[model samples]
Target: MKKIKLLKIFLPNSLEETYSKILNNPFKIGAPNGFEPIKISESYACAKFIEEVISKELIIDPFGNTEEVTSKRYIINEFTISRIRNDHILILENPSRSVRELIRKLSEILGTRFYASAIQIDIHALSEFLSNNRDSIHLKNTRALLSGVNLDKGSSATIEITSLKDAIHDARYHFKGKTFKIERARFTASSGTKKSTIEVRSTGLISVHGPDEKSLVELINMFIAEGLS
Candidate 1:
């Protein structure tokens, strides 16, 4: 089964001039490869603020950067995306490229200070049954896995996992009384990304947080390699 995971690196306050350059000069900054800039907005109380998503196509090592373009969407973090809390976060949504490769590339572009905090990885894996056998699945499993459970499009469940192999099992145990056809599941802690059509489908998500940067990298590597094994 193909899984979708997110790695968000929180950074310090961006230099105003740098932020401005990203917002204003997107074309020169580039994107992952074919992705174009989409306008992003922040919400507070009742007001909304629009901010340009500074972006550029990144070239993965071994492959290097390519001028060849395709329509497939993959938006890498050009700069950090800010939440209302004023925390600047560099978010890689449903990234398929190597996280380490991305980090190196971003460092070249934005410098190391941009990744001021430990990296946060949100692990996601949806059942093969979801897209393959939607009609036959039970509502209980649907609600248990997906937020705002609906027959149509909706939000995904964000739950953390301690063990990737037992993700579905954990979910079943956690939501024991809930009716569902799925046999396993897992969840993560609370946390939070943008644009592009990168879809992260999971019955549960494992969210990593805290200040321990060393352990954080280990956990990220573990999940990336063994999460789906």
Candidate 2:
């Protein structure tokens, strides 16, 4: 299934500030054919359009010779800013420098800060997803298993399990009403770092395990950065 992840753009102030800057001030940006302003409201501001840009691709001939070809491509994207409680969330496809650039322009115009970051999934959502798909995660669970499923404080420990799948014959426990945290994840060099088992449900619930902490943070960034694949 196609994964859908809404990237996070941190605004310097709350949603109310956005209203005074753009929504309240009311201004247009870019050419009429590019970055068109769609709508603004008391609740949210939405803008979306297709953008065409030049891109390059590699071609392999039957003789095993390789060549680079350049062409034009269109990018479809949407951006919405709204107040979810107290936080101002920038909903957009991430790692797209174009989008970030647009935000940068807006920042310069409004004198605010908008930062593109990789920390998308919050701790609670990840904790819930891991609770259910403990066996299906991408992290090195063998270490956690070998380290033992249960432990008390005040002791140094190191445990190892061959693999999460291999632990099918292992034990099960009832961990209801408990809180879990995701701190680290990694794949062995032998296994490589490519991960493909993540599923983003239709409801927009995404649960993706990672090869490492940095990889997980760059999940959405890599999605578009390597979109040619």
Candidate 3:
């Protein structure tokens, strides 16, 4: 499995303005080669959109009733973009092909003229695989589990980052050597100052485990400033 997320930075704008632009001048973004153009909007989760709008052939039964699409779609190289909240949320989930092209398209549509932030790249490694091939990836500075299935056990590293794009670039570079299938990767754009925003994004993954809120914020800052190197 593979995940791709992008965070587009911009000066503060009203939700109304953002919403109006999306509704009036809708834009199409890059997607997996055979997939449809990435749709940008202010409503609908990825799964719901697929079930209601995309072809039935493209939709598959989710692993759980919780709305998560099954992993089978990965083989076909599909992708989805979730609803965006202009203040600080732009999500691209399960981009199975042409990650670079997709990002470029998004950058063009979103307009880089607005100060954009680093692209955050997140990849989840199957715990079992990490256990079997510890030497493949360098997550040496292990910390306590922050999020994910086994909250008490899963661990990750605090790879510093100067920007999300560079960090993700470096992550992809390392991901090549590990050979472990990626479970998820996300790109986020935000003011990291917002607790609600961060919480919404950290719904999964054993994130940077810190001793306290201040420390956790520091870790996120480091991540956005430098790619996990």
Candidate 4:
């Protein structure tokens, strides 16, 4: 017999509890790769189906960041399943653009309503900023500032990496009169995950991993916003 499972891709670490709750719903539907939604609720059965359908473990690697690989393993942390009458209401946390698009498309086809958020920013301008300031200690200080603010206000910033050639070019041409050169740039969001570190290279790239694609896109968008602002 064919196996069945629930495969949900959410923005990394964004809606932890919300997704966990959704996973608990016995009546929740399952759709693989945009296929028709299937209803199932048994965690054990779902686990078996997931094992059979997805050969490798669900691991999201962005920008080749090794830290994400070393972090915690993926497992159902906590959940609760229940149902409500017509007077009942369901609430979901904010989601990324891609996630929203997928959900919207699914709802449209299925004749239902789904909601998601699409965070936006400019990658090119941010890249230009990092490229121009390769030697500026201020860039590092900016990271420190943002990191401190995250600690205080509880938020994240997005970042990017660049190649050495690009860094040098920006430093020589774009930031000729500037006293500082930025060696790297990174964007991130943190919620009490201590001792987080990001490394930006000269290739004009930034790397991080989300629990899902939506989270990854949100992280990238966050970095762009911070870099430009």
Candidate 5:
């Protein structure tokens, strides 16, 4: 699964100047490659994905290099930062721990400190959406893992759905006489006769396992407007 990170960049008031700085200076290093910006429409001015080459000091080569000496090794931290015609939210493709430096560089280029956070989607709302739109979306979420504080005891529990896929759309599994609210779920969605699947996690990572561009866009829009805080 491809893990993408979403960031809400706080740009300086001079939006035009910020773009000019990014277009010219571009916190990017090395030669141009596939991450280069392309024109989509007039809604967006410029978009560029960055691949950073960083070198780390290796105490000893783990790949059979002689342990007698330390050397500098290079690695590529790749991620695409697309404005996507949306200034409020910045999409980071395949984010990793090293991506924090990329975010810092961007904030420096913008001359402002932008905060980063995982785009946490409300689990309950998402399940509600899927359950209501059953005509276009056919999916199932089993083994809902719930974690919360009740009274004075904090607990996490996992429950299973014993019914068929068609009957598991209730959002929460009922056991005995209590309904357990699901706090985390993996939604696998595909339209009628389509083989591709779109996966949305409650942890705020939106990954598309298929080539459903239309659905991806729709989901992103919904996420941008309602997902991030």
Candidate 6:
């Protein structure tokens, strides 16, 4: 009979329960280097059991935003099965900035109760594919498809004045350049200061940011309502 030394298994679910069950079996022994030596059948069983356990608990939301949740689940499973592999490494990839922060916070939260194995977050590697193809046609096409309507060439103008009174006046009805139907414009006072800013952008297409959120929102709404006029 050929001796199978190492077994690789991919489990979509919980690894903790699987590891515990494997450890309790009589035939397996914990090696000094951290891996547990087991018969091939037992190793296969552990992997299968992990998959079944995970399938039951995992759920996909309607929005299809489960990447973060799935990555963490895999990490947890790997940590629980650390002793099963001689050198266990859990490599997580392509997590968002917020997700990365959450993982660190979770590690700290679970620090005392259950020790997690060495976890490596490889963000750079995951994004490496995008880095190499920065100028690809596919990327350009994709961006164009998702971008809002082009409002750059439409009738628009910007005037900078020293006084807020002048700025608001110009934004309202002073300039008669193109008369592309004034959508909306807003003026906002600078916080903790005397200066202010104004912006007016067209509706469902472009947005102009000013000194405050209120100005931005109002301008956007106005652009939508008046742009059609």
Please provide, for model 1 over 2-27, each residue's C-alpha lDDT reduced to its tens digit, 9 standing for 90 to 100.
23333344443344533443444343
Candidate 5 has which clashing residue pairs, if any? none
Model 4: how far residue 151 lies from native, Å: 41
lDDT-sorted candidate list, best first: 5, 2, 1, 3, 4, 6
Q: For residues 76-149, could you state the per-residue lDDT of candidate 2 as single tens digits?
A: 56666654444445555332445544555557645656665443333233323443443443332332222223
Badly placed stretches (over 4 Å) of model 3 are: 1-8, 26-87, 99-112, 119-229
Show where candidate 1 strays beyond 4 Å: 1-4, 15-18, 23-36, 40-80, 84-86, 116-229
Report the Cα lDDT for residue 44, model 6.
29
lDDT of 4: 0.30
Specify the poorest-scoring 10-residue window by lDDT in model 5. 32-41
Worst 10 residues of 3 by lDDT: 44-53
Residue 129, model 4: Cα distance from true site in angstroms: 13
TM-score per candidate: 0.32, 0.39, 0.27, 0.23, 0.65, 0.17
The segments of candidate 5 whose C-alpha lies over 4 angstroms from its true place after superposition are 1-3, 14-16, 27-87, 130-134, 149-171, 175-183, 211-214, 227-229
- In candidate 4, stretches whose alpha carbon ends up further than 4 angstroms from where it belongs are 1-24, 27-111, 123-196, 199-229
What residue pairs clash in candidate 2, if any at all?
146-159, 146-160, 147-159, 186-211
TM-score, cand. 1 vs. native? 0.32
Q: Using alpha carbons, what is the TM-score of model 4?
A: 0.23
Expressed as tens digits, the lDDT of each residue in 112-226 for candidate 3 is 6434344533333222222233242222211112222221235534333333333334544654443232333332322233321122133222232222334333344334334
Best by lDDT: 5
Using TM-score as the yardstick, the better of models 1 and 6 is 1
As for TM-score, the candidate ahead, 3 or 5, is: 5
Ranking by TM-score: 5, 2, 1, 3, 4, 6
Candidate 2 achieves a global lDDT of 0.44
